[model samples]
Structures are given as C-alpha cells and as structure tokens.
Target: MKATTVQNTFDDITLWNKMREGDEKSFSILFKRYYDDLVSYGNSLSPDKEKVQDCVQDVFIDVWNYKEKVQSAVVVKAYLLSSVRKRIARLYQRDHIFRKSTSIDAVSFHMEFSVEHELIDDDYATKQKVLHLNNLLNNLPARQKEALYLRYHQGLAVEQIAEMLDINYQSASNLVYRALITLRKEWKGALSLITLLSSGSF
Candidate 1:
C-alpha cells in the first residue's frame, strides 16, 4: 500500500481501539467523519434521501451495538459501504422497490470520482477531455459502467465490490475486464491524438 493508505489504515485502527474502549468522544468523531460518505453512498443506491438516511442511521446504530463483537475490519469504509448496500437491499425487498419501477425507468449514474484528485494534475491533457470521455463512458451498459466506477473511482477491491454488488468474485473480475476492454477500444485513438497534439507532432 502507498504511504497514505498505510496512514489511513493506522488511523482507522486507532479509532477502532478508542471506540472499543468506551470512548464516547471517539465514537462521535468516527460518526461525524464517515456520516457524509455513508449518506452519499446511500443516496446513490436510492435517490430517496429520507429512506437513505434511515438506512444509514440504522446501520450505525447496529455498528455501535455490535462494536464489541465486530471483527476489526481491514478496510473500514468498504465494510460500511457493504453494510449500507445490504441494508438497502433488505429495504427494497420489504418495500418491493424494484416492482414499483419497470425496466424502462432504470436510472443511469456515472461514478462521482471519489478518489479523482489523486490522479489529476494540471499538465495532463486528459483532464481537459474528461467531460468528453465521460460522455463516451455513458455509452457503456449500466452494469459495465458501474463496475468500472467501483474499480477506478471508489478504489475498491474486486472482492469488496463483489460483496457490495452481490455478485461472485469471478463476475466482478470479468465485469472490470470487459469494461476496460470497451473503454480502451473506444478511447485509445483519442488518447493518442492528445499525446500527439501535446508533442506538437500534428
């Protein structure tokens, strides 16, 4: 892992220890830190903010209750996301949310670039063409786009994404591969053009 990743892991470990030791302040700090991220992810699963909030609240409450018994997570954020997704899935099952919407009403979402800043720099022409590239990305089928977003934007492992998306390891791995194949096939020429232009070779 990179230094930042190692640091974050250590921080989470410290926070987990504090929370386990009955430190109310640490509990509040942890809650405040991840609440917005949880809310955003919840809203993504369903646009109903009220329902999302309820699910997030419930997940946290459960977390607090089970904090003593909960195994120390390797990636705390991914574990939280997985919990939120499972909670929402259960809600959908109870409310029959899928039955309410036909296939035609399916919502399309692009990745929100949660980890985008680390990959961007002023010098990269690719940054300038993001809007166009995202448009091209929209051409991909929904599941393919989702898999790509989870892999690249969210920085999730295949196992974590598979658990969150409720798919098998092989399916998640293949999904990323297929999405990359399509993206590279479509975007290769554009990237080469940018490179050539930047080099004043045109």
Candidate 2:
C-alpha cells in the first residue's frame, strides 16, 4: 500500500480528523498552518513573547497527547485560539505578578495597527490619515480591540468570537458594532479607510 500524504490544501477540520487518527503528517501540516497566527494572537494577549510561544507549543503538545480523547472541533482555528487563551491565562495565574487576574477577560490586549507606506499613496495627507487611524485602533478598549481583531483580521464570525471570548453573541456583536461606530464618530471622513481595514486590505 502506498503511504498516505497530508496536503496543506485540506481544510482544518479534515486535518484535525486525520490528526486524531494518529496521522503525524496531518498534525504537522496543521501546526505549520496555524503556528504564526496562534503566536500573533498569543502576543496580543501577553507581551512576553517567550511565554506566549511556550503556551502555544504546550497547546499543540496537549492536543497531540490526548488526541484520542479530545472531541472534534467545528472550527479548528477557533478551538486552537481558545486553547491558547486559556493556556496563557493559566500561566498568568501561576505567576505572582498576575495571581489576581484569574480570568482571560482581565488580561489586557495590546493590538496595534499599521499600514505599509507602499500600500497607500505617497502623499503626506494620506500618510497622516493612516497614522490617525492606527492611533484610533490602538486606543480602543481592550475587549473591543480583541473583538475587532478576531472579526476583521482572523475572519471569525461573531458567534465564534463570542465562544472564544466566553461572551454572549449580542455582546460580541455590540463590541464590533460599537467599535466601528466609535471610529466613524471620531473620524467621519475616514469611512472608506474603515471599510478597507474591515476587509483586511491593510
């Protein structure tokens, strides 16, 4: 019999299922696929890059160790993201400095947005607008910033975000909606820029 190969083109759920069946190639593919995204999301939650990286690694390790016992996830990306968040929270709990912060909600999110200069026009006015937009995004409340990041950057649905953040659907929707409303209120003339940002053009 020919050896089976795992293709990167396979959807996450398919890879996840293969992994559960002890397919190392599928597991490796899944890891390489989401590792960077997981690291980026982990860094947003905790500034300690080493700790975040460790937590992300531990998440994969745990999954592999208990692959037979773990249930299949409807959305593999969301599941991995939620696992990273919980792992980081547990790590924080073990640290004396963050002992009081037991919940992921208490963790501050540090999300920053930047537009590549080459991606936009070279005019000074457009540059200033981009800077202003980045400033506004970085100033949003932690929860709002996180919500927007999941929705816009990760392409996660509101319900998936709610589950990942442990919030209700309406709250998740409101977080995104209010974030956009606040941006529009503060930068009324930048609607097109906002649309581009939401569309992940940046």
Candidate 3:
C-alpha cells in the first residue's frame, strides 16, 4: 500500500509536468483523480447539490484552459485546489446575485419604500430586511461571497475548503475572513434591520 501511494505520487508529478507543457492526456488523468474529491468538498459548502457539481466541473475545465501556463510546485494538488477555490467563490457570488434579482416585484417594493419608514412596520421590515440581506450578498464580488458562503453556511473546515478549491489553506482562510469583514462593513445596515425586526422593535 505504501509503495502504491509513492508510485501514484510520482506519476502525478510527472503528469503535472506534462500538463504544463500542454499535454491533454496528463490533464485528463489529473481530472479523473481529483474530480470526486472536488465535488465532495464543494458539496460540503452548500446544500444546493447541483451547484456543487457544476462548480467542480467548471474547476476542471478551467485547469484545462490554463494548462500550458500552469506550473505546479511538486504535484498538481495545490494547483487544482487554488483553481477550484476561485471557481467556487465565483459560482456562489453568481448564485447570490441571481437569487436576489429573480423577483422583480419584491425588488420594486423595496425600492419604493424608505428604510427608516419601513422600520415602523415590523412584519414588512422583516421581509424587507431579508430581501436587503440578499441584495447585499448579491452585490459582493463573486469570490468574496462564495468564500463567505462556503465557510459560514456550509460549515466546512479551512483545510477542506482549501483542498476543494485547490488553494493554500492560508489563502482560503484569508478569502473567507476578508469576505466576512467586507460583509460586516457593507451589510451592517441590513443586518441591523433584521435584528430590529426579529426583536419586535422595528
């Protein structure tokens, strides 16, 4: 078993080198090896099963496109992680935006009312705040929002999230932390609105 592990590692290193030189078959081998793991990692981030699968497929396609210029340190693992991290982040951000904007009537209603005035109507304010949270989420950069969703909503560990996205754990950690910081800063108003509504003080 130990010998098999060593051999697989050696093969991966060789395949990575070939992939950097534009070898399609090498890329394919790496894809097959990592595909299931990547999908599993993504699924750990969100309950939306289809989105997780799509993100993993997109990650592999991205690696293929950037194969010629992609350089791995020792094996393809890190490169794959980084690639998928970026892809997942973008996917979540896209999803957030679509979910927020899909309801035109809700959006129109929000736009028509004043935030301060809505505070007097508890039920209305609560609904508005929910929409506002979605709005804030939609406005974040694709990468930032995904990092936040995967970390906060999915409850995945940093290492797992990093592995799924093909990023260094530190980098993934930073993305998740930074995204939260940005959200706290940018969406505090919406959060406050929700708090008020929930407390029956709106």
Which numbered prediction scores highest in lDDT against the true structure?
Answer: 2
Q: Tens digit of lDDT per residue, candidate 3, span 1-202? A: 6643533664778888877788876777777777775665555455667876887888777667876766666435545544555565666566668564332111110111123444444566556655675566556655555555445444456776666545688988887777556546544453463343233211
TM-score list, all predictions: 0.70, 0.88, 0.44
- TM-score-wise, the better of 1 and 2 is 2
How would you encode candidate 1's per-residue C-alpha lDDT over 56-124 as one tens digit per residue? 889878878878877766577777777887787677666766576322113334333321323444646
* Number of the candidate with higher lDDT, 2 or 3: 2
Poorest lDDT segment (10 consecutive residues) of candidate 3 = 104-113
Candidate 2 at 74: error in angstroms?
1.9
Model 2, 9-128: lDDT tens per residue? 688899899999999988998888899999999998888999999999999999999999889867888889989998888777788464455777776678686645565566788778
Among the numbered candidates, top TM-score falls to 2
Steric clashes per prediction: 0, 0, 7
Candidate 1's error at 52, in angstroms?
0.8
